[model samples]
Target: MRINADFTQRVAVHFDQTEWVASPAAGVERKMLDRIGDEVARATTIVRFAPGSAFAAHTHDGGEEYLVLDGVFQDETGDFPVGSYVRNPPTSSHTPSASQGATILVKLHQFAPNDRTTVRRSINGADYVPLFKDDHETVEMRSWPSGQVVPIDAHGGAEVFVIDGGFTEQGEEFARWDWLRLPPGTRTELRAGPDGARVWMKSGHLSGMV
Candidate 1:
């Protein structure tokens, strides 16, 4: 139940190389990247929903954040197509389903307990988009041009998920769906690959919990 739970270490994962493990819901499977507990746990994952698949209504006691990677995602709130970024803050509840199948990168039980902000948006075609920012964390989507070098300061840890193309950081290459987590105080530069790169990033949330 503890997968890459160490906050002080740097970790990287190639999304496509991971095994798909079935979730409690039928037709819904997940590739877990990090976890700290059991079924109801603090986790980060890439989930896929087969056509017509659905999950029962559930409340996010510690909040939920996700991005639609492919296909369409649906819930009582509305339908979200690929490139959609959503945040269902603490105490929100919803029954999610995918009528025509979908894939998403999701984070569960990782919000400040008192946070209640809700956000839903599409980042398709966006060169730079700031999704959310609070005292605890900052989330954003950014695109890098080919061969461009961008500096990053992980003041309180940082995570990057490659959406399209590729990039290299400290000699490590990251392609589509690849994920990288840098520990607090790390300062680095990411150089875009030949085709450039678009990525989703989160930072400042890992300040002191470790």
Candidate 2:
């Protein structure tokens, strides 16, 4: 069960641009971008939980990383409101639910073994540090103004989420909630639209594998 499972190709799946499909969980709905499993897979997705909805507890064999795009997300641990960044590294477990509805950009089964742990960050308190002129790194979350180019650094590509506002690159337009996976060694430049987009971006993990 492989859906865009290969890391050698450039893949982009838009959430707003693509329709969603139902999940095995009663109140949970998912739109899979790239996959490699059963009803659940090694994919990137937009998952929505209906009010008071929840999934049974389970182990994440390959880890889970996600960002709260809208509403409030909760589990036994705590509640993550919009603009939260989370990382549940390899061999972690949880039963996630949302009582007030929620939307998330989630990447599954992607993590370095040494990275095992759980992370919860309030992105609103994060700061953007300059990696280089015209290129910056946000250890947190924030906006990238229109026409601002941030190269993905050709040596190792990147993954991106259009969380708020919209972004365009190489003639591709990504609206809110869109997910993109650019393979290692691919150069990318993002230009925000009139909305002056804010995106959650990550890179350098494609090389991590079982």
Candidate 3:
């Protein structure tokens, strides 16, 4: 099934307002953001694992990327706590689970054919750095001070995910976990709220997806 599968248009998902759908595994559920194809698909989602829940071992043929939103997520390699960002490149495999429970933001099958770099970081421990950059694509994380107005010119499309606090865009307030995807050539105006905000932003990834 397809949901928000069109890349040519803009999309925004306030996860707090979405309902969770159970996954194939017991005690695991997901709030789908964008999806294409069937069970095996290119997708973005917010996933949750109830205590003692686990998923069978699986290979990421097209790569997988995720950030732990709360609690802890674990696999054969190690445990990832809240704020951990990880990227398992194409062909990687793992069996994921949660002992105490966890919530994560994840993307599947969205890597470029030749992109094979693997990364694991903690948003709280790592200094803000450029995550990815090229003439056509860029990704980064930044902090916005309270009352600051930040304007963005997305020449080849843009996406933003709030990591902390809240921000307003076109008068709509977006708190942690809110995600926004905009089409190419769009300009966005964002203003930080009283507590300020921290966000992960990406641009130019939609250049050809549209």
Return the top candidate by TM-score.
1
Q: Give the TM-score comparing model 3 with the true structure, all chains together.
A: 0.94
Order the candidates by TM-score, highest first: 1, 3, 2
Give the per-residue lDDT of model 1 (tens digit) for 1-210. Answer: 899999999999998688999999999999998998988999999999999999999999999999999999999999999999999999999999999999999999999999989999989877999999999999999999999999999989999999999999989899999999999998999999999999999999988757
Q: All candidates: CA RMSD in angstroms?
A: 0.8, 4.1, 1.6
Give the worst 10-residue stretch by lDDT in candidate 2.
129-138
In candidate 3, which residue pairs clash? none
- Candidate 2 local lDDT, 76-153, one digit each (tens): 789999877787878788899999999888888765556655677766644342211113112235577766766666
Q: lDDT (CA) for every model shown? A: 0.95, 0.74, 0.87
What TM-score would candidate 1 get against the native? Answer: 0.98
Q: Give candidate 1 regions above 4 Å deviation.
A: none
| Candidate 2, residue 64: how far the Cα is off, in Å | 1.2
